[model samples]
Target: MSSNNTSQIAAASALGRLSPVANAPSLESIVAAATQLVPLLREQGQQTEINRRLSEEMSRRFEEAGFYRLMQPARYGGYEYGFTAMMDLISEIGRGCASSAWAAALGVIHNWLLALFPEQAQDDVWGPTPNALMCGSYAPVTMAEPTEGGWLIQGKWKFASNVDNSQWAVLGVQFPPAEKGAPPGAGFVVVPRREWTIEDDWFVAGQAGTGSKTVVIGKPSFVPAHRRLLFPEAASGKAPGTAVNTNPVYTIPFLAAMPVCLASPLLGAAQGAIDVFVDMCGSRVTRGGAGGGGNRLSGFSHVQSRLAGAAAAVDAARLVLDRDTSEVEHTVSAGNAISVDKRIRNRRGHAYSAKLCHGAIQDLFTTVGASGLTLDQPIQRIWRDGNMIAQHITLNWDAVSTMAGQQMLGLEPKGAY
Candidate 1:
């Protein structure tokens, strides 16, 4: 067998030996190592803000650790590893630095998403460098027209995450018919950064370091037709990735996967809070005598109970997500339709995971005392970032619940995705 094939066999053998029901790495070890690296991230957090993006040093560390390659096809520079491990890894990063994790999460997942594009689009993005990073905004931010070989593209796509560093982007648009608004059909049009300029638009009260700017593409540029994609297929239960990837994990619904990827960073940020709170609570000596028994916060029955509940929520939410991914993977792998019931379950589970982590983080913030209120505090950043990101529709638990409930009751729910 070839050397590459040998490596795959060896890795698969090792994974088999582990016999993890999830078929992934030891989540704890990954979390521990990533947690240890958080302080280093925290030290450079201000620098990231000043640079208006993640520091090259931080990005290099992530790349060196093979973090960016998590979602890449193994034939390229990637592990093609378990989706669970990817979630564990991103959560750790989020705990330390939400924006870095958010940016990295977006950039990394884009690699996987590329596998869903047409081979020509894949060539346009990854043909250059397997490690080539791409970022994008999907909310139809411009006008695109049917033309020979490509679309005549114009307009600025906003919320383009990690744009300052990305080599390419997937700017989605709805191509209107020659007639005024004949049914709307969506397509993701690929554009190289060289053909577009990034506007400084990501300044905000939270996730400030994401550098989620806008891509301003005008008269000077357009993406070819081969680099574009149809939407109804993805919205229903299809994606081009199956033809190229042959990986069951990539077979999951396109819109479904977006929220799953996003909630991960938020969970990681909360876990980061938990890690710190545990440390801080362990070392404290309150007026009540080492908070009594020298166990610090652990000695306080109420604190212990809260921690227990929060930890339970975190674990519970993770289990739901794990179950959802597995089901999605299994069904799609077999060429089955992902039922509306399952999709609703997936959405509800995703929103709950985000909410669970949000509640846990909020509880920790309240319990961490005045130290967290300072601008220099790590918990403060985590608290702000988590709260802000949880507001995203993906984590809006009420909406997910409402939709799921309506669907179960044989009622139609409204929304594009």
Candidate 2:
């Protein structure tokens, strides 16, 4: 066996023989760590928004906690935990700062994708330098030309969250021109920082701190074939990395499981808005009316109704996310392929839940009166972030609903469903 193969075997064996460390971190402990960061993150939300990215200090804290390794392969010294653990952690962080949660989620989630590449590719990415942060944009707008040893790719990938903090990126690239009657080809190209440049263009109102700027592939960079992960293979829940990383968690359909990352943060943001609004309503006395100075806003019937509606919607969104994700987990554990219909349903389920979250935040924001309009208020930030998240193409309810409808009608769904 080659050195890399020997390393994989040794690492796997170590993981198998490993005993629980004293005070070893559990998912609950990780969630608590995230919760502990909330107050500090909330306090820094405005500053982070102005900076247009998460602080290096915050990123270091996350790395120190090993929070980003939740979905990484055990051979790479990762926890290889389930998606639900990650969801809970991200949601807890989102309750403090949506942008922080978003930046963190996008930055770390790519580790799971990286685990799908060939062993050599995985070694190239994480072997010598196992602690590198990764980010990606999966829009196949790049131009790829066939080359001797690899493909020469050139283009810009937009909305790459936390690109400023990453040392490597997974960029979407098209397969070389297909022959007549052949299906159009698409896949991911993993490239180190030396191959690409980060463009500063992430300025926006909502989730501004994500720093989801454009990634410019400076000149034509050559990515070897080993670094490529075809979308179809990933959709089928099989990939090169599966040969070494045998965990079922790593085999879940990429698209179906990824929506949780995009939607869960928004769910938590909406919940945060509700939390802030509820706390505000309790102490602030009503001004200018028969009930002025006598009635708290929480006492008003309309306020009560709006809070109830918002809370229920947020709860329902969380439930939908957990339910669908749990089902995907169970299916993977059973060694079964997730049906196309199920993937479509998962897509729509995420979009629907995000829509509900948007509406809940809207209701909550609308009921908060002028106080919510101020940029300083946490509710306003949550509202803005939730709105931005709802606008994500993955969470576009109308499009997802159409895809689901087409699948239901016995027609092929289109466009990354």
Which candidate has the top score in lDDT?
Answer: 2
Alpha-carbon local distance difference test for all models: 0.73, 0.84
lDDT of 2 by residue, 121-196 (tens): 9999899888888889898996688888888999899998988889998898888656877765899989999888
RMSD values for the candidates in order, in angstroms, are: 6.3, 7.3
Candidate 1 stretches with Cα past 4 Å from truth are 1-36, 178-181, 286-299
* lDDT of model 2, residue 201: 89
By TM-score, the best candidate is: 2
Q: Residue pairs in steric clash, candidate 2?
A: none
Candidate 2 residue runs with Cα over 4 Å from true position? 1-24, 177-183, 289-294
Report, for all candidates in order, the number of backbone clashes. 2, 0
